[model samples]
Target: MFGDIMGMMGKLKETQKKVQETKERLNTVLIDEQSSDGLLKVTLTANREIKSIHIDDSLLQDKEQLEDYLVLTLNKAIEKATNVNETELAAVAKEGMPNIPGMDAFMK
Candidate 1:
């Protein structure tokens, strides 16, 4: 019985370490999306921090069109980053969830 308890504790510690590592790595992961015409581009981290933007110089003369392209590009980048975030969270879940007395039944 004591050995079984120790084994479970070891598994729990390993899972916690993996979860922490995944979260740290997520901040460094980059996800990018561009407008359909490729005039605008946006890059963000997997954790949704906007890192950079690129816009064609030709669009700068027209404020309205520039705004439209910016919006479209940003939204696409956000969507992509969100999908990446979900995937990362799921990977962490597959690693193992926080240990609780009775949560395993519900999590599975």
Candidate 2:
């Protein structure tokens, strides 16, 4: 029993290191979106950090239009980021697991 415990501890440490590395990589994931008319663009990381936004000069004269485009573009970018973030995080979660011979049965 003691030997098994020690072995499990070693695996746990390796899993922790993998999870940390995966978390760091997760922060690097990014997604960008643009308006259909090409007047507005928004970029954001999977962690929800806004990287940048670009707007065409023509949209600046109309406050309402610009605001509309901003909302639309931001929503699109956020949606994409959310989808990508979830997928990436799920992959990391899978990675964090050590493939034990019988652990799958236990997990189920």
Candidate 3:
């Protein structure tokens, strides 16, 4: 029993390490989103950090319109980034998890 516990502990530690590595790797994965009219664009990392924003000159003339476009585009970009981040981390975590009978359900 103690041996099994020790093995599981090791696996948990390894999984933690892999999770951290995956998070670091996500920083390099980029996601781009733009407004429906293509006048506003936003880029984000899979880690959900905003990388850049590009707005058309026309948008600069209408502050309210620009804010609306930014909010919408940024939200979409953030959603995409969150999905990527979760999927990648979940894959790594599931792969590294030890065969603990009930844990499979939780992973799913």
Candidate 4:
């Protein structure tokens, strides 16, 4: 029984290490998302920080529309970033513990 407990502890430590490494790798990733009209685009890091933005010159003439488009594009970018983050996190959780029931729920 003691030996089994020790082995489980070791495996848990290994999983923790792998999870940390996975998070670091995810942090280095970037996701790009854009608006339907191609007038606005945004880049976000895995940590959801806005890394950069782009705007087409054609939208400059319409300030109101440009503002609306900018907001829409930014929302799209954020949504994409969130989806990517969730997917990556799920992958990491599965890789770390495929048999651990409800592990992801606990992690979240």
RMSD of each candidate? 3.7, 3.4, 1.1, 3.4
Question: Of 1 and 2, which scores higher on lDDT?
Answer: 1
Off by over 4 Å in 4: 61-63, 98-108
Least accurate stretch of 10 residues (summed lDDT) in model 2? 89-98
Instruction: Looking at model 1, report the run of 10 residues with the lowest lDDT sum.
Output: 91-100
What's the count of clashing pairs in each model shown? 0, 0, 0, 0
Clashing pairs in 3: none
In model 2, what lDDT does residue 16 have?
Answer: 75
Model 3 segments more than 4 A misplaced:
none
- In model 1, residue pairs whose N, Cα or C atoms come closer than 3 Å (at least 3 residues apart or on different chains), thus clashing, are none
The sequence of per-residue lDDT tens digits that candidate 2 reaches over residues 1-108 is: 999778778877877777677667757887878999888988888777899999999999999999999998898888888887777666665655667688666543
- lDDT order of candidates, best first? 3, 1, 2, 4
TM-score for each predicted model, relative to the true structure = 0.72, 0.71, 0.94, 0.72
Residue ranges of candidate 2 with Cα displaced over 4 Å? 1-13, 98-108
- Deviation in Å, model 4, residue 83 alpha carbon: 1.9
| Pairwise lDDT winner, candidates 1 and 4 | 1
Assess candidate 4 and give its TM-score to the true structure.
0.72
> Clash pairs of candidate 2?
none
Can you give the lDDT of residue 32 in candidate 2? 77
Over the stretch 1-108, how does candidate 1's per-residue lDDT look in tens digits? Answer: 999788878877887788778778988999888888888888899888999999989889999999999888888878888888888777676666545689767755
